[model samples]
Target: MDVPNKKTVLVIEDEIVLRDLIVKKLEEIGLGTLVADSAQEGEKLIKEKHPNLVLLDIMLPGGMNGFDLLERLKRDPILKSTPVIILTNLSTEDKTATEIGAIDYIIKSNISLDEVALKVKNHLQ
Candidate 1:
């Protein structure tokens, strides 16, 4: 059963270890989570679940990348307002990410799992 009023965060990442760590951190902080390995799956989850926030990775397995998904989200009338935080190893894409409509950009290597969880908590507020 779903927890009442629990905010769900969708993590779109291809790295299994990182994705699992992220989900674990978020869950430890009392948040619900949904995960996707590619942009297409992420988009599907966004449309269906309408999660409170999204933690997206830049490089994905599918043809569509995170930027592509971000653009699509920005263009969608209903989903445009959904908050997205770019969680990737790329430090160069921060400007492009924010300009493309992401609320924040996180460089995975530079941050700890605890910090990531804290950032997500702050964004959820």
Candidate 2:
């Protein structure tokens, strides 16, 4: 595919390797990317940069988990409408993800990098 325009995506992931991989893929496809090692980091970027979308992980380090971050985003009228997609190995909380307005709950363990990029791009569009 041709490189996408400057659609920015915030990736909130704890695993360094996975986070880098996702960022690389997003960049390769021409989507501007931001990396946040935890939900707190993601939130800070959201407030400061306000990316077009976010790929959020369910489990994260620090007091602010992904769901906690989602709750915060939902409460903030300014960011409540920002699109969020849940990309996590934990599927047990799919219900909560849906209830909290995640555009999609992706299981990383069973998906390919290309597919992940495709899904993210689709939502960002």
C-alpha TM-score for every candidate: 0.96, 0.93
Candidate 2 lDDT over residue span 9-111, tens digit each: 9999999999899889988888888889889889999998888889999889898889899989999999999899888787787889989988888898989
Q: Any runs in candidate 1 off by more than 4 Å, and if so which?
A: 1-4
Q: On a 0 to 1 TM-score scale, where does candidate 1 land against the true structure?
A: 0.96
Pairs of residues at least 3 apart in sequence or in different chains that clash in candidate 2: none
**Top-TM-score candidate index:** 1
lDDT of 1 by residue, 30-125 (tens): 999999999999999999999999999999987999999999999999999999999878789999999999999999999999999999999999
lDDT of 1: 0.94
lDDT values, one for every candidate: 0.94, 0.87
